[model samples]
Target: MRLWLAIIVGKICAFASRFFKRGGGSSLPGSLARRIEPHILIRLLEKATPALTSVIITGSNGKTTTARMVAEVLKHSGLRIVWNRSGANMVNGIISALIEKCSIRGRLCADVAVLEVDEANLRHVVADIKPGVILVTNCFRDQLDRYGEVDTTLALIRMALKDAPPGSTLLLNADDPLVASLASGSRCKTMFYGIESLDLTSGYTQDRNTVTDMNANMNMGMNTNMDASDMNASNINASEYLPHDARSCPNCGAYYEYSLITYGHLGKYRCPRCLSSRPAPDFPALNVVAQGAHGFTFAVGFEHDSEYDSIGASLGLPGLYNVYNCLAAIACCLLLGIPKMIIEEGIAKSSSAFGRMETIQIGDRSVLLALVKNPVGFNEVIRTIASEGSNKTLIVCLNDNFADGRDVSWVWDVDMERLSRNPSFIRSIVASGTRAEDIALRLKYAGINQEKICIEPDLDRALELGLRKLAPGETLYVLPTYTAMLEIREHVRRRSHVREFWRA
Candidate 1:
């Protein structure tokens, strides 16, 4: 009776929220419903969705995009997907998504529930909702104040996986040692997906000393005027590297040697001390080619196997990060018996999730909004920007909100030197958010001239300043933290005829 009442109240609240246009209303109703019934999520899932195939995606980075990709593919395959499309990925948010999709009598209409669970909240959610498939996209150092280090984040996920449903298929990133290591303890059926070849030509040096030097530069901050030669940026792709983020073998304390590098700590790596190496991926994205900010194309699967033959796939979303997301989605869909053609169509059709490289056109000007919360992810965004080759107008938004992570120090670890490789290419930069001045200082240190950089803490004013500085028809790239992304996106939506992120 309490559960039914909670469902009724939740449905009413959801209707009111949508009618009033009160944000996305993705989590508030679930919070209220949960309050009415403490075990609302578990009770509702069991009573409502008995045969539902639940896909739980949890990782430090790429969870939202990966989950979105999976949901899109499943939708293309004719399954009704209920996902937290608004990026409200918490305990309450997951419940709210379910409640929003469920009928007044608490009957969920969806065939599959693709959920991107926050790293910390995984344990809380999985303790109740037994997922059919669990995908861990890649583990990177994120939200230092909240998640501490990558190991802490890994430990949290590991604990949650332990509580996951028995016999659940674990779709892991074979390239990410941290993610691959999760399969060691678990008895669940595990399958891996990764890039077989990234086709990186320039600055491709995959050696131990190169990693050591990069880590040294990261530990001891690089000089403000540090040129390309000082950090060996040209020889080894220092900008793509993430210091000591994923060097050490998860099994042993020894450093890893990479045979090939695929941006950050993801690549073919082996530990000399323990002989722990990258697991052979089942769904390998071979011959990967980057198409810059426009996106990339890769052939998935190997040519040898007839049943699992290679098929070409392309993603419209920018960054190799999205490629990883694509691979995870493809792997999950394939495992669920979806046809390769359907997967390709879904991959090609998948749109950016809110601020994950979402491009908005305001009259003649094109605005690209991307969310950057950590060093590795920020470096990839920087890489995508540098790849454009054309002159750039950038608005970097840095917030210290709790959701955006309180410690704004992670900005220091970003490869600003790489972004400033061709300083003349960057026409202007507006540092905006709560820590606008901090990012302005960061850019200044990274060799950006003070004349070209402006500090506007208010997002509205920042957007105005950035758009004003932007030339007509040129792309205005706005890199924002989580909260900053939401704020700036809302501001953009009002100015233009853009749909709400959840609907988009």
Candidate 2:
């Protein structure tokens, strides 16, 4: 009776939310449903068990995009999918999604359910979902105010893994040391995905300093027989001096040493004392055959593959981060026994999920929506913007709401100086959101032209300012925090007559 009542009430709330135009109300309905029946999600999953393949994508970054890619791959294989696509990653939000898709009788109609779950909500979700496949993208210092430190975030994921079904497949990022560490204690079967080398530098654009740091690290690590072509270390513009999440080895407590340092703390790491190192990837991008404006050409070799396969896929998105996202999705598809050709085709056809480099047109100008929630993510966005040579304007929105992380100090950690490195790369900078001044001041400190820095706390006004500055052929990069991304994307969607993501 409680389960039925919860479902009925949740359905009504969902309907009323859309009717009253009070936003999606994704969590409210689920929250109410949970209150009525504490174990509603578990009960719902039980009803779908044995038939539905539950998959959860969790980590500090790339959850949404990776989940979307998994859905697309599964869909291409002719599997029906029910997923939470609206950036709602919490337990209630996920429950809300299930309520909308599953029959009110509490039975699933789809072959699979792909959920992008929040890191903090891991234990709660795992108790209910017990996903057959869990993909941990990468762990970074994100939402420090909420998670405290990198280890805390990692610990949350480790805890969640406890609830995943035994013998479940864990597709992890081998490049991320922290992400890879989850495999150590797993009762689950684990496969890893990572890149070996690249033909070009990482991010939207390459700063000389970033490139220098990467090459220096690569050169440092090149001392061994590890093939440079196999490592492709020079292809990324990684910062060695930046605050790394893994400074020392978790196993040995020795200074974390690296043979190759990819973007952030991801790369070939080894602890001298314990002989700990990056495990050999099950699926490794052995060589970057080519890197162009279109997409990446990777020589991918699976541990079990007869030989390396060179696949060239064009990206509808930008940034090196997307390249990593592609690798992660391909790994997931491969594990599900999706045919190699199908995986390749699906990745090539994949679009940027929602606001992560989601582009929309506001009149004649193109607005590129990129979500940046942490310094690591934001720095990559800046690099991407710098990659575009000229005729680009930026509108960055920073919100200090609880959802966006109460502490706004992470903005300072973003190396905004990359934006000003190429004078023609950015023409105007508009800072918006509740903390518009803070973001604007951060940019000014990064060396963007003081006169070019504009501020409008109002979303509508900010949109107007940003669009007015763009030329007919130029692009405006709209970078926003979690909450801000949704708000800004909605505003752009309305003006551009595009479907809201939930509707899309």
Badly placed stretches (over 4 Å) of model 1 are 201-241, 302-306
How many Å off is the CA of 205 in candidate 1? 14
Residue 109, candidate 2: Cα error in Å is 0.5
The best candidate in terms of TM-score: 1
lDDT of 2 at 358: 73
Q: Lowest-scoring 10 consecutive residues by lDDT in candidate 2?
A: 222-231
Checking candidate 2 for backbone clashes, the offending pairs are 196-231, 197-232, 204-384, 204-387, 205-383, 205-387
TM-score of each: 0.92, 0.90
For candidate 1, the per-residue lDDT at 431 reads 95
